[model samples]
Target: MRLSQSLIPTIKEVPSEAQIASHRLMLRAGLVRQTSAGIYAWLPAGLRLLNNIADIVREEQDAAGAQEVLMPTIQPATLWQESGRYEDYGKEMLRIKDRHERDMLYGPTNEEMITDLYRQSVKSYKELPQVAYQIQWKFRDEVRPRFGVMRGREFYMKDAYSFDIDYEGAFVTYRRMMLAYMRTFQRLGVKAIPMVADTGPIGGDLSHEFIILAPTGESQVFYDAAFEDVDYGAANFDSAKPDDLGRFFGIMTDNYAATEEKHDLDVWGKIDDSRKREGRGIEIGHIFYFGTKYSKAMNFAVTGPDGQKLFPEMGSYGIGVSRMAGALIEASHDEAGIIWPDSVAPFKAAILNLKQGDPTTDALCEDLYGKLRKVALYDDRSERAGVKFADADLMGHPWQIIIGPRGAANGLVELKRRATGEREELSLDAALAKIGLNAS
Candidate 1:
């Protein structure tokens, strides 16, 4: 991606409406633009990264044995009515009337719709443990939407549902989804703690909210230091097996963690002072085991082993995909700008031609850019070195390859690591190898 040829509208002045660092940086960096209250139009650069985040979510879900099926943003109102939540969902539900005067809505969540889909197809205990997921747009119609995408009305989300034969089956499915959430967050370049949470309108007795530490977070959380060192990738638990899931779930339940909404000082006091971690965190994902809540309300049932119809136990898990763009900024940014993690960065590195049009400099940058084009954003714009440097830092590419007439003539390039303010002058091939461009 060449900066001069691309639509990344990096700007100098911050927008007046942006209330938080993430919001300000997003606007100034030209990642997104507010079209209406809490509604944004994701720009090219932002859209790419947003899709990357969704891809990671999809991979984790698939690895955890969940199958992906896209659900529509708009759904029939009857689905909500069938689950007895039509009136209970409140104004956040974007209820609308179609041209035929039928009640419809931009779905806030898909519990009822998914239940309808499930009951219409599956009819026996033989297909009892199916998990379906979707990554799509959702609308909540927040009355006071603020903080950019953080509290947006229309946003991207990944919601997954599990249908199982009974409570025990549902619990195992829930644990698998929870494990997926933990791995997803870790890969998204943030450490998140699973804290006990209120299910609210979702109506679940067992729930966990994955909260990421950020100074600007809305909710306060407390957790044991044990969460800091868990090797999620090394868990080696199979999602399909109940015993494996039960063991994993037990490990999570044994951890001391709770959000302010469900905090307990009695239990909190028991943890060693050195191991107690108290801080504010952003809710990045949530998982819940809501046994038969929707299935029973919607009168859905599958044939049991004994030939009787029984409501399947179920659960729902959610991750805020669009909000994560803002959340990632909140959790990882420094004074300069975004400092994106490699796994979700729009481009792995930015190749800055410090002296654009200089024969030697331009040639060196062009060669390097060609070699790294698949994972690099080439800054070929005719801007000052300072302007290019500032914009590169602001956009937060993991690395910046600085090329100038002096360095180009010497057959060397400056490699700058964005996360740490580390720079090294190295031979062109050495620089390429250091940035993983020519690594064997």
Candidate 2:
């Protein structure tokens, strides 16, 4: 993609309304544009990043045996009413009436609706241990919508619901989802620690919130440094095995990790001084095991193997697909702009034609761009080198290939890594190789 022909409208001045680094950088870097007080339109680069995150979440969920399904954004009020939460759900829900005066709502969560769907299809224990998930837009009319996408009125999310025949099955599903969440965050290049959390509105006695560390986070958190040593990617745990999941759960719970609200000083003092770690953290995902809550409320039942009717145990897992963009920037950005991790970066690298009109520079940049066009951005605009550099940094591509007259003439290209302000002049092949590219 050529910047001259692209839609990345990076701004020189930060918007006054942005309160956090992520919010400010998102707008200045042309990731999103606010169409309303708390609603936004994701531009090209922003949407690409969002899709990348969603893809990883989908992959991990699939690996955990969760089937992907698309659910409606607008849900009937009857579902909430059946669950006895319609009037008590508070004002954040956007309730509406359709042509025939039927009460409807833009769903904030799909607990009731998913339960209804599950009851309609599965009539026996043969379909036990089912998990369904969807990645879709959700809305909650926040009283004071602020902080860009972080606390927006409308956002994208991945919400999964699990149904099991009994408590034991539900617990296994919960642990499986837990492992899936850890793996998902790990693949996204973020260190998300799971902590015991209150189950608000979700109505479950057992709950955990996955929080990622960031200096500008909403809450102070205390955790054990041992969490840092657990390599989730290479862990030997198997989701299908109960013993493995039990061990995984034990490892997670053995560590003392809690947000400020739940922090216990008595417990904190018992840990080894060197193992203590404290930092601010942002909540990126949550998991809850609310056994039979929805099934009992909605009269959802299936025949057991012993020919007895039973209400299926249930759980719900959620990850804020859109909020992650803000949380990621909050964790990884610097004063200049966002330093995107390679897994979720919109573009892998940028090709900068420092001397756009110079024949040698232009030729070298064009050749590199042609080779890496799918994963790169070519800055071919008639702009000064300083302007190109500033925009490149603000856009935060993982690598930048600088083509100048001097470097191009000598068959050399300057490669710079965005995370660290490190640059090296190398032969074209070596530069591409260092950037993890091939001569395909």
Best of the candidates, lDDT: 2
Best by TM-score: 2
Worst 10 residues of 1 by lDDT: 233-242
TM-scores, all candidates, are 0.97, 0.98
TM-score of the candidate numbered 1? 0.97
Relative to the true structure, how large is the alpha-carbon lDDT of every model? 0.89, 0.92
Q: For residues 27-95, could you state the per-residue lDDT of candidate 1 as single tens digits?
A: 988899989999999998999899999999999999888999988888999888888889999999999
Model 2, 1-440: lDDT tens per residue?
A: 89999889999998999999999999999999999989999999999999999999999999888999999999999999999989988999999999999999999999999999988899999988899999999999999999999999999999999999989899878888988899899999899999999999889799999999999999999999878856666544444555756656776778899999999999999999999999999999999999998999999999999999999999999999999999999999888898999999999999999888899999888888888888898999999999999999998899998989999999999999999999999999999899898756
